[model samples]
Target chain A: DTAVSQTPKYLVTQMGNDKSIKCEQNLGHDTMYWYKQDSKKFLKIMFSYNNKELIINETVPNRFSPKSPDKAHLNLHINSLELGDSAVYFCASSPKIVGVQYFGPGTRLTVT
Target chain B: AQSVTQPDIHITVSEGASLELRCNYSYGATPYLFWYVQSPGQGLQLLLKYFSGDTLVQGIKGFEAEFKRSQSSFNLRKPSVHWSDAAEYFCAVGARLNRDDKIIFGKGTRLHILP
Candidate 1:
């Protein structure tokens, strides 16, 4: 069983289009996060939701929005996707203690 | 502000040889350290973590790391390198304010395996 799962393992779209990535965790974790991995393999946290409440919001562009339907699900919606947005988007979850984060198979987005 | 640094951008090691990856962090308190490995086209997998107690922590894939508070460093080491171990390794630190605080990741180090 996958502890953390994400949809759309790969996404290819034209610039200026909007897309969304969904993530879920079955480990009963209360905290979910969104991270972006650029071509240089730098993983940076974009946003975090704790118990369905927005907690940490990095200096990411406003086009990226995170929505948490419940504690187990967090979805990221990006508007007016730019060429720079073509990166691997990863979703992760952690217990309240924030020990080791469980990551899902990243979604590789390509902007044309 | 807290941050993690992985000095070596890339490292190469022959198969069966020992490997070491250095990591340093800047934080005000006793920081929580972690090591994660990411294979090509895959997400990051936790290799090990150091919360407290023993300064040494063992992890999967025959990897281990030592937390040196005085040095403000947590270096990962493996007795022998495997070809499959050639991937990107990241060092992360957890925020101490909130247990669920976000994790700050380093730029990551790419390991090259020489067979």
Candidate 2:
């Protein structure tokens, strides 16, 4: 079984259009995270949720919001998306705070 | 703030050649460290990690890393390089972020295998 999965592996949308990326993990991990890889391939932590509680929110723009309905699912919603939003978004889950993280196949977002 | 650094942006090696990727981190305490690999159009995969105990940690795909506390480095080394191993390798440091912990990643080192 796929330990981690994400929906709409590739997303192409126009600027100003809102979109959402869904992530789910069957590993039963309590911590989930959202990371963004920019054009330069620099990976940065965007948001993190531990047991459905907002734990870490990096200096991400207000347009980006993460919603975790349960410990298994965490979705990212980008509003008023801009061209800079074009990047690969990855979702990861780990059982402990400092354990190895299992990552899902990222969703590549392209804002035209 | 804890951070990671991968000095080599790109590395190329012939098949069967030994490989070593450098990773350095800046943290006061003994930090949780990890090495991850990402292929084209794929998510990151954990190769290995070092939390404590033995400084030399073994990982899958015949890869291992040695944690040198004095150097603040956890470098990944492989006995032989395969074409399948060509990918972007990332080094990360686990640190506190607000109320929770966060894994800070370096820019990544792209590995190229030559036949």
Candidate 3:
């Protein structure tokens, strides 16, 4: 079984369009996180949810919002996407707040 | 603030050659360290981690890392390099706040293997 999975592996949308990326993990973890990797391969943490509660919100823009319906699922929604939003988004889950994180295959989003 | 730094952006090593990737962190207290490898068009995979005991920690794919408190460095090393090892390496630092956890990842170092 796939430990972690993300839907719509590749997303290509026009500027000003809104899109959402869904992530699900079957590792039965309590902590889930979202990360963005820019073209330069610089990975930065965006948000983290522990048991469906927001724990860390790194200086992400308001347009980007993360919603966790349950501990197993965390989805990212971006509004009025801009060119800068074109990057690979990854979802990770850890058993504990500071445990080893298991990452999904990643979703590549392109805003043109 | 906690931050991880990888000085070398890229490194090339011949096959069967010993390899080492440098990683440094800036934190007030002892921090949780990790080394992850990411192949092209793939997600990051944890190679090894250091929490407390044993400065030298072994990981999958014949990779190991040593944590040095004096220098705040956790460098990953391998006895021999394989072409499959050609990928991007990331060093990360995890810190526990009062009621939260924060993880910072370095920009990453790309590894290239030569025949």
Candidate 4:
């Protein structure tokens, strides 16, 4: 079984369009994270949620919001997408102790 | 703030050859280090991690890493390279200062294995 899973493996939308990516983890982990990998392959932590509480919010724009309904699910919603927002978005989960993180197949977002 | 650096952006190795990928980090206290691998069209996979105790840590797929506190480096090494090993490798650092102390990742090093 997939430990972590994300829906819509590929998303292509026009500028100003809003889209959401869903992530779920079956590992019974209490922490979930969203990371963005740009064209330069620079991976940056965008947000982190632990036990349904917002733990970390990076320097991402306000258009990006992360919602965690429960410990098992975390979703990312992006509004007014721009060309620069085109990149791969990854969802990962780890235990509360911050050990090895299990990641889901990334969702490639292309905003034209 | 903790950050990771992967000096080599790209590396090419022949199959059956030994491989070493360098990683460095800057932090005030002992940091939790990790090495992750990402294949094409896939999410990142944890190769190994070093939190404490012995400096040398072993990971899956015949991968290992040595942590050098003096040098503030954690380098991933493989005895023999395989064509399937070609992928992007990322080094990350985790801090304990905050509950949400997320893992900071390096830009990543792309490995190209020649058969």
Report the C-alpha lDDT of model 1 over A14-85, residue by residue, as the tens digit: 999999999999999988999999989988889888899988898999999999999999999999999999
lDDT to native, each model = 0.93, 0.93, 0.95, 0.93
Judge candidate 2 at residue B45 and give its lDDT: 95
- Each candidate's fnat, listed in order, reads 0.68, 0.84, 0.73, 0.77
* Deviation of model 1 at A100, angstroms: 1.4
lDDT of 2 by residue, B1-115 (tens): 7989999999999999999999999998889999999998899999999988999999989999999999999999999989999999999998643456688899999999999
Q: Which digits, one per residue and each the tens of the lDDT, describe model 2 over residues A1-112? A: 9999999899999999999999999998999999999988899889989899998899999999999999999999999999989999999999977578999999999999
C-alpha RMSD by candidate, in order: 1.2, 1.2, 0.7, 1.0
Q: Give the TM-score of chain B in candidate 4.
A: 0.98
Lowest-sum lDDT 10-residue window in model 4 chain B:
B95-104
**Candidate closest to the true structure, highest TM-score:** 3
Q: List the residue pairs that clash in candidate 3.
A: none
Note the chain A TM-score of all models in turn.
0.97, 0.98, 0.99, 0.97
Model 2 CAPRI rating: medium
- Candidate 2 Cα deviation (angstroms), residue B12: 0.7
List the DockQ of the predictions in order. Answer: 0.68, 0.77, 0.81, 0.77
